[model samples]
Target: MSTTPSTTPEVRDDSRPARIGIQLQPQHAQYPAIRAAAARVEEMGADIAFNWDHFYPLYGEPEGLHFECWTMLAAWAEATSRIEIGALVSCNSYRNPELLADMARTVDHISAHDAGTGRLVLGIGSGWFEKDYDEYGYEFGTAGGRLDKLRDDLPRIESRLGALNPAPTRKIPVLIGGGGEKKTLRLVAKHADIWHTFGDVETFTRKSAVLDERCAEIGRDPGEIERSVGVETVQDAETMFAAGARLFTIGVGGPDYDTAVLADLLAWRDDKNA
Candidate 1:
């Protein structure tokens, strides 16, 4: 198998539009509600939609309604007509890197079928949900150690992608989430096409500086990595945009899967693009 560069691999700009995405948290909602939210977000002109990779809900209640990540992504692929879909950040610990690549490739094909527009952005991060590790029986180690594995495995994942029978119709964009200055941002500089983080404008500005330094240290251009931030409302949207964040993600929860907030986000997206 051909081993691709483990760090800072070249990415082709595929003419995908820049816009907003929402992480449809699987906690409180049922499948029907989640499907409706996906349809509504696409109709509102959001460019992408996402879900978290966790066995249980991250918030609300620990044992609340939840869905698996890759499986749910396959469903989203079939359910939506326009928006790009993937996990906001899939946990790397859950699956072997090669297997994850194959799964992503399969979903990429599923999304592209008949529609001709297939997009899957693999947003991955060092696994952090302790309950998931405990329930699934995977060892929860030091954060640094998990990030180390991520750094080592990224190239392997890319290498395996080339060997898959039907290569993904398009080059999959790798999105790394987290803002750990010592390792996470460094990994972002080295491996990610998109870097996502959660914070306010001040926090984001500070972390961006650290990420820039990491890029310089690694001999990579910081601008090559798309800066993404999670937004909760329109005010946060404007703040993040002003602070140099080009990609904004809002999160909506399940069961009720409301889109009232999404309407405002879409208006802001149009204003920025207009």
Candidate 2:
């Protein structure tokens, strides 16, 4: 799926202002508490809200008060009107591609309001987590195999979105998460509107250059995809932004869903944009 760089201009204008995102970790929090936190983050001026796709907690107790991803997203569609919502990266192996497309379309409609059309970024990636595979009876194939599946399914998901009776409210932006220099980055150059990955300034700079090379091969301007990264503090955000990350996300766990870290990052975003 190589797009000729000369033919495909940038999908997004990078000159746009930087934005902030919040990954309100679903583990260790009650449903009501999570709901409140989601709303509060939007009220606090977050540009987007993300939840992970996993059956169990990624940290702390293995078995904790974790909530399902898509279901919570559905509720968020109605619970909040201002903020966009989606999985940080929905595991491609967990659900059929067509079904996933339908689910996204439904949520897109649900989230659509007078303020705007439905906001759902179709963030997806190959599945990981052996526990999720074992307990759910999903195939925990080799990493390459999973990547192959993801490569095959993305086009199908797009096709399904086009074939739906009522299409998505807007062109759902595809956010592909991962930093695999080979297959993963290639897919991002071909399919993703936003690319999310993690690494320090040096690592990010190297991988980002690789991504641009991939885009050039396919004929798409590297700037077409927005660069996003997870940050633990304002300092990390500064480093990543200096390396070209435009979307900064902060993840917080639990019962309280602390927003202190988010406050600092948000302020940083304002300062940068200002």
Candidate 3:
């Protein structure tokens, strides 16, 4: 399989003010609420929608209501038309790199067939949730070890796509989430088309500078990698954007998935496009 960039058509608008993606957190929500929230986000003009691949909620209650990631994305792909869908960061430890590539490819096909848009931006990260590993019978190792595995596996994952019987109609964009400067950022500079970090404007600004330095060392242009950040409140949106965060993600938990807060974000996105 050739490692060169696939000839798939570029389907995203790179000029837009980054993009506003919502993480449909698998917690405190039910199926209907999650489904409705996806629809509302699409209606409100969100560019992308996402869910995390975890067995439990990351916040609120430890064992709160939750849903699985890939399964939910398959549903969201069918539920909405105009918004891209994916996991905020699928854990690299859960599945084999080849299998994961196939899964992502299948989802890409589903999104294209259902919505007429093959927009599956895969946001992947080194495994973190210890509870998930314990419950799933996987080993819980040091953070460095996990990241090493990810670095080793990413290229294989990319290569596997070419080996698949029917190639994905699009080359799914790979978004690597995490801000560890030494290891993670280097991996981002080398492999990621998008890099997602968590923090306020000041934090993102600092880390982004480090990322740029790493990019230089790797002979990669920092501008080539899209910078993304998670927004818990609307007020931080403009602040982060000004700090060089083009991709802003808002997380909405389940059960009562409300999109009221997303209205401001969508409006902001539209303003930029307009």
lDDT, model 2: 0.89
What is the Cα-based lDDT of residue 237 in candidate 2?
82
For all candidates in order, the CA lDDT equals 0.84, 0.89, 0.83
Q: Which candidate is the best by lDDT?
A: 2
Quick one: RMSD of model 2?
4.3
**On residues 164-263, what C-alpha lDDT tens digit does candidate 1 reach at each position?**
9877888889999999888898888888889999976767877877777888887998888888889888888777676677788888786777788888
Tens digit per residue, CA lDDT, model 3, 1-274: 2223232322232353658988888788778888888888888778889899999889999988888898888888777767898898999999999999998888888888753557788889998899999998988799999999999999999999888977887878999999997899999999898999997666677677777788888789788889888886666877776667778888878677777778887777667557
TM-score of candidate 1 against the unseen true structure:
0.91
Clashing pairs in 3: 28-254, 29-254, 29-255, 30-255
Candidate 1 CA-lDDT value: 0.84
Better of 1 and 3 by lDDT: 1
lDDT of 2 by residue, 1-274 (tens): 4332232122333585788999988999899999999989999999999999999999999999999999999999999988889999899999999999999999999899664699888899998888999999999989999999999999999999999978888999999999998899999999999999997777777777778889989899997899999989998988777667899898888899999988888888899999
Q: Which ten residues in a row have the lowest lDDT in candidate 1?
A: 1-10
